[model samples]
Target chain A: MTDGLPMRVTATGLPARVRIHEVGARDGLQNEKSVVPTEVKAEFIHRLAGAGLTTVEATSFVHPKWVPQLADAEALFPMLRDLGGEAHLPVLVPNARGLDRALALGARRIAVFGSATETFANRNLNRTVDESLAMFEPVVARARQDEVHVRGYLSMCFGDPWEGAVPVSQVVRVAKALVELGCDELSLGDTIGVATPGHVLALLTALNEAGVPTSAIGVHFHDTYGQALSNTLAALQHGVTTVDASAGGLGGCPYAKSATGNLATEDLVWMLDGLGIETGVDLGRLTATSAWMAERLGRPSPSRTVRALSHKES
Target chain B: MTDGLPMRVTATGLPARVRIHEVGARDGLQNEKSVVPTEVKAEFIHRLAGAGLTTVEATSFVHPKWVPQLADAEALFPMLRDLGGEAHLPVLVPNARGLDRALALGARRIAVFGSATETFANRNLNRTVDESLAMFEPVVARARQDEVHVRGYLSMCFGDPWEGAVPVSQVVRVAKALVELGCDELSLGDTIGVATPGHVLALLTALNEAGVPTSAIGVHFHDTYGQALSNTLAALQHGVTTVDASAGGLGGCPYAKSATGNLATEDLVWMLDGLGIETGVDLGRLTATSAWMAERLGRPSPSRTVRALSHKES
Candidate 1:
């Protein structure tokens, strides 16, 4: 133990650090058929943060009539403070009422949803695409007055199931609008799971040409067509830094019928780790958490990395 | 009809072509439970060509103890000519003896297997790395003298199951060796299917750095980890145009325990057609072919694209 070889154990860690925003508590629950207990959701966030996630989206304060699964958002966010303050838990707010509920729950960081395609906006939010943006303007302004950091979501960025393909111009328009509304960052969502690497390159390149900084862009991809990680790498190649991943691969847009699952956080971290990108996560722990949640959901963990590593390895 | 409308009608009238390379007769049959009858193999290839695969691989001519499934290679390849030359059948030849059998069967083209890693070479070919390559040199020379085109195969381009990670140096070394050995084209196989888009880029870049031309490198991927199509896109990005796909997702490497299936040709063609890549394939007909093969295999086809379009759309 006293030899120089033993003394020279410290090595420089991973080169580039990729920040993972865990969306399980919110995005995962949004698609659940079972009415998840609010206590379970709060406990889920606690376990996620304890497992080393810095940012976990806590809940969405939407109307109870529509998404009954997360209708108890009012009680969830306040209970998060009792859990701990180490993790920054964000809530999804749609309008002033939703924002008021989030603020009442003592939410500091929050996210709002927007759609690029007009057809999707009309079908989902009962408004045109521009009307949806206009609605979020005051919500962003109100959040700014409260000094809350807001993340804006631009869904149907890749393709809409109903509308077929959403144009990149629509994506650029929606993204620029969200940024102008004083949102801290914009996350693009491929609502339908029909995206490939080529579509990712074209969309991200168009966004870059539209003057949106890559650092301010976050990617929320579904592994439905099995191209999420590839799209993530394409965005990374175009300089996108922040990525959103669902823990245990628990993800599906509420409006999407076959919205299989999001990019697994475990797989993304695995790829990034192999590429020398430091994702400040314990993969072994993360895989365990995902497995536990999947068991709770009565389904196998959808993350291929989790299955491979957990089954065939230490 | 107006002149413009007539032009559109004519475009629709012309049959949509698809280069259906039937790997099942070789790639699929190589991993079956029972040794198929040689006439059954011919009938399968005939049915496949009738279903519209112009190119099909009939049998493998390896030593009997090595690959007992294709021990009837001498009987199988010759019987394929009785399919009335409807299918352009190619056979696998491990050495000159196999080549002699193939030439006796009048094989115009032959596929030679190589490995990008020494570990795979030992497992797959039963020889030390260079010894395997040295083994193929005279075999290729003999094919050249007979004016037979050799399609070289490099397995485990991304990784090998025995060895955790394959060095890019090994991939370039083997690819360059095959091309230099007079193989007309190369199809790099993701043997264990752990490849991601980044790994594909790294391997392709290494091949390019080693002065291997992109036009000759076709990707042969397995959907084991659900990364095949994304990896295919990475190859296309770097100008490696050709890709190898199995119909009805009929093949998985027997040595790879976790591999789900090969990349489905119908699915790949859907993405390629969407991206406007001229793969000379018909999507609808390919779906029918996949279904017919799936019925014969007594299993559900492994293509989601076909299932979705057929059940949902039709």
Candidate 2:
């Protein structure tokens, strides 16, 4: 509705409208110890969609064994068939089998991931970056044949838990491969949250130099180092439009061993508003959703902004 | 000696030493829900000084009726008498009465606070900004008479909780007044953690224009908005050297009525190291201090960097 223009109102006059992809229902819930009922996830997705999110990562179509927490995704997807909102509910599909499962559940949107570091790739997918890319090619092709829009995730773009600092070229190599393979958008994820603003800018500059369009790039950062939003600001300065965040700061990356949880959606929106970037998110609604999710999980949110602001209003 | 530099690593190539001030034993404990035993706080302060902090804020001398949390100041100061191991113990003194109490207890160093914003001045001390300065002048005058090295605190320099946005002129006006009052060093506090790098730069610029020496300025920031380290970077870029941080990010402003805790000393040290500033402190020891403090308080640290880095090593 804002004409896809970056210009925002009355804050800083920089172009606004940063697209936010709420990954709470899937990415947030996938690492929980308790089994969240399928109906609850379905309702969460509906509520998120209603809260003005243009992209809600609905659920991952991976096997029940690998992610026992998301075992309900199979039933949840089919039960929540009515899309009353306009956002894309893209599901994660690791390979041809996962893509088949998602398609069987009538999924029209899917995302594939390849780690930028060989260590992280093998650690997560039991394959190297090239091998993971090879595996994802056919999945992307199949999703395309079904007229599904494919997104790509490039993990460990900042640092790998096993191999240490991931070089910008490694990130570019995987991101370029994903972009060239017809993935519509590629998200660079700081899985361990160690990326400084300098690292973010350097990697983005490398990708920009390699001729990847900035428009096709998204950022997924963790607040482990308290640099997520600052890094986001740098990304925005470099023309990155899409960002992935979890409600209530849910979902720690168990793969990183003991890293901080994903960046909080409410916190991200709070910063974006201050910077005059529109996320089309209702702050009050987001806070409500996060509070609901926090209570369901029996945990306090990892979001300081949410906690601070909520207490002030009361 | 780190050449008395704010963040410079080598004092003109003489090898910089980073100075850490342990505020947790005092500021951190003062705001906690549980009143730690006098022995516990004394032990904590002793341990902190042993861990190599050159300056430790021993305790505050505010009215016992105002902050019952530190009412044990009567019992606490006597134990720390000649107890500092290679460190200077400074106590927070609010008024002439508080100064007299500290002087009675052999407190040789004291910190006095004056707010830039009228709203904060009223809320914190039930006085106007000028009225607050009037109160500070007599304390500084008395400290001079007692040969006390007075480090003045100018609260709400960047922003205020009740006042919303504070102008840089307002801050400079107060800072100039504090300097004129014979404060040896002035620490500007972002009381509610509402400062951005831009805000820091604006205030510093105005202070510089007002003939305030950067060498005489220190920064005290809260992490409520996750901008403390970044603002610290801006400070370094502007040549303001002294910094005040709580041991575990424990020093929340009681006046702000928010959990706007002080910048974690460990995290501050981490950033300073990355920026090549020589702060003579062991990161591991600082982390241990915060972690230990958190466990004692029955809570996790308010420091993102400390939590992330500590977990990574574990």
Assess every candidate by TM-score: 0.84, 0.85
- Chain B TM-score of model 2, please? 0.90
For model 1, residues B1-314, the per-residue Cα lDDT tens digits are 01110001111111232244557668866786776667776767766666555677778888878778788887776666666456567778999898887887788888899887777778778897699889999999899899887889888776666666677787888889888989987888887667765667677777888888777677888765556676676667666766788876677777654555787776676566545555555566777766765666677776655554454444
Tell me the deviation in Å of residue A210 in model 1. Answer: 3.9
Top DockQ model: 2
Clashing pairs in 2: A6-A15, A6-A16, A7-A15, B6-B241, B9-B278, B18-B279, B18-B280
lDDT of 2 by residue, A1-314 (tens): 11111112123323468899888888888888889888788878887877788889988878889999887777888776777347788999988989888988888889997888888888889997898889998899878888999999988887776777676787898899998888988888988776765567678888989988888889998877666775676677677889999887888777876466788887777556545666788777877777777777888787766676666667
The DockQ values of the predictions, listed in order, are 0.15, 0.18
Q: Give lDDT: candidate 1, residue A18.
A: 71
lDDT for each residue of candidate 1 in A238-308, tens digit (9 for 90 to 100) = 67778899988887877765566788887786667556566677777787888778777888877766676
lDDT of each: 0.74, 0.76
Error of 2 at A108 (Å): 4.8
